[model samples]
Target: MTSTVRRAGAFAGVGSLALVAPLLGWAAAVPFAVVAGIAVLVGDGPVFELFARPGDWEEGRLHGLIGFALAATGLGLLSTVEAMPTLAFVGAVLTLVYGNLAAQVVRRRSTDPVVGAVGFVLGGAVGCWIGILATALLNGDSGVAPAFVVFLSASGALLGALLRSVLFERDDPVVVLSVGLLLWFLWELTDPGTVHDVGIALAVTVAVGYASYALDTASVSGMLSGVFLGLLTIVLGGIGWFAVIIVFFGIGGLSTKFRYEEKAQRGVAEKNEGARGSSNVFSNAAVALAAVLAYAAAPIHLPVGDGTGIAGGIFLYAFAGSISTAMSDTLSSEIGGVFDRPRLITTLKPVDPGTDGAVTWQGELAGTAGATLIALVAVALLDSVGPTGAGVILVAGVAGMTVDSLLGATVEGGRLGNQSVNFLATLSGGAVGAVLASGLGIAAVA
Candidate 1:
């Protein structure tokens, strides 16, 4: 276990270094790549032992691990032909996956797709991070390269995967912090105007966190302090995507406070009277943050229909939809509870105002209205958003709200936690928005 811990820590550091060095040549990063490959290959042995749950592993030798190391070392030679560290890292990943699969075949092991993917991303990210960092440190002077964006985005995926992994369920909070910064350091290659972005998110988070604190929205103790800072950084990094989030915070925060006493009396009020902690924020906004990052990092263009393809795509719609979905759900639950008679969405049977899956006409309307308001606000902020995009946001919001209700009626608070439900709803809304935006030009021409 001690050895496993050391390996994990060292690999995590390697990933952090890789993230910081996107500008370096793949050739220069060969050494870092070799080390990371060895770390992962060796760590697999004890790491499997340390965190392995029942039915998690199969009989295997070090052959696959050796092949992975050799492949990485060979790919490092690609620096002679291609200077890009990301490319070399990609080759290593492909080699590692193939090697692992061949090992599984030889051992007759039953592979879990989820676990396989987790292993690839988690370990691959660390390897990639180190490779890029070495390259940049050894040969950098060109000011933030495009490879940095590629690294940051990859790191985000790795960060998300690590966060959601059950390996840390029983572990200390340090588990998250350790990997999170390593992944975030991937963005160091890019010199974004973070002061403005961070300032915006911090100013809002502090004000809202403080107000919620004063209003008993949640106990200050329950609030995850780190979540606030992390969220601010995410928003700041997302650039134009921050406006919709601000809209979400302003509206969602107020709705939670509205009729707080009545909600408490009725036993339907949000826990802590909607003074959300870190988990609440993450549940409601994490998907939105991811959408915004996707948009800002790589804007997906939709064809405006005049011959140029993907000229009209606006990922902002997806970002707005996620925020809209979160707000719609919040507004309906909070505002609707105060003004309308409750009806069970599943059965149409009257229920107490706070009953799970309960809905009110007033709440439904408020939810739709909230979605519309945010859709407009988001588009206005971006100086983008067509009639079709706006309408699609509204639809996605309503759809997500319904999904939330369905989850609440069945699994929420039990098999699926409230945070999980929120994440699913937001994700659904983002997908809907992206799909709709993809066809905006077609609809416009039609």
Candidate 2:
């Protein structure tokens, strides 16, 4: 048993590295070793605890390592070909840290190897993709940077994971994992280059599509719709495309939240419901397309201030909203789930946990506050867009609450196959908010 355990520990370490190898590259092994050594030296707890049991140690460890390798290898390959930017590198590091932390938390709680493996895979892939894209766009001199980025990123990942394990012990692993990955991906794509724009757009679209498919809730039709929208945004430009992606993330979160509640209430054998929702893809695509159309159809030019011309404003808007939505949703759901009272959205009356259209005062207030915070973030980040641009986000967030309520009260309750209607409603609300803000002379159109 002792020998098996030791062998399992060794395998787990190597396997985890292997899983991230594609994205991190073989050089990532150095960071992995460094991280593991630091973890051991700092008395960070047992490094081998990620495995399930002595009997299952070898398999479990191997699984984690393999996932790490895959993620690292993929990221490395993409970065090499695309020449990622510094921001992308940062994003990757963040994802790695957060993802591993989340996995550790889950493992401690459930002793489920599958969950841990999934968490690592998801986190690593997301981190790598984000880092590669960001680097490609931001770095003026890209060739030399990527070689060192992997090690630096690996170190960051270790820090993030350790922080999660040591600090926020009770936080939901799924939420943390998802948000970490999303941020990493977004940051990578933030730079303003034509090639970066196209590559990021394509990557986002593909990722969203795969997420939709993996979740199993999205139909083939809905996935196609998302892809079509993504393509359209790319044709339109970065601003438009990015805006759409943000909206999609928000909608997707809402849908997933609802589905999880429903599944739990039904006493069904709860599968991983996270993979089912496609609201993120739909909302994001819609926002991006709208921005492009706005730019194309409008007589006035909106100054984006990023040297990328008028389209920059649109991109900023989308990017801000997207990041905000992802953050807000994660915060709201994870924090609010623990709230003493969760209410329905429609009547403000307290209802059962899974009741459609139900709103808890706690949840409603929390959700609004969360959305507002995100809106503010969007405004603050895109300084070039002007204060009026911030106002648009505020209005959109407010309108999103109303739109979400309306959809939940009517369309969402009806269970019309997917969450497309809700997504569309939110998109409409955002468009209305943007239009009103523009018309009110709060901000000039680029």
- Give candidate 2's TM-score: 0.41
TM-score of each: 0.57, 0.41
User: Model 2, range 84-194, lDDT digits (tens) per residue?
Assistant: 433443455446544554565566667653455445445544564455445444444455344233422332343333333333322322323433343344333322235
When summed lDDT is taken over every stretch of 10 residues in candidate 2, the lowest stretch is: 166-175
Q: Rate the local accuracy (lDDT) of all candidates.
A: 0.56, 0.45
Q: Model 1, range 249-365, lDDT digits (tens) per residue?
A: 657877888988888888777785576665777788777665544433442233244522243244455667788899899999898888557888899988877777889999999
Per-residue lDDT of 433 in model 1: 75
Candidate 2 residue 145 Cα shift, in angstroms, is: 30
**Backbone clashes counted, model 2:** 66
Off by over 4 Å in 1: 1-191, 194-240, 299-314, 442-446
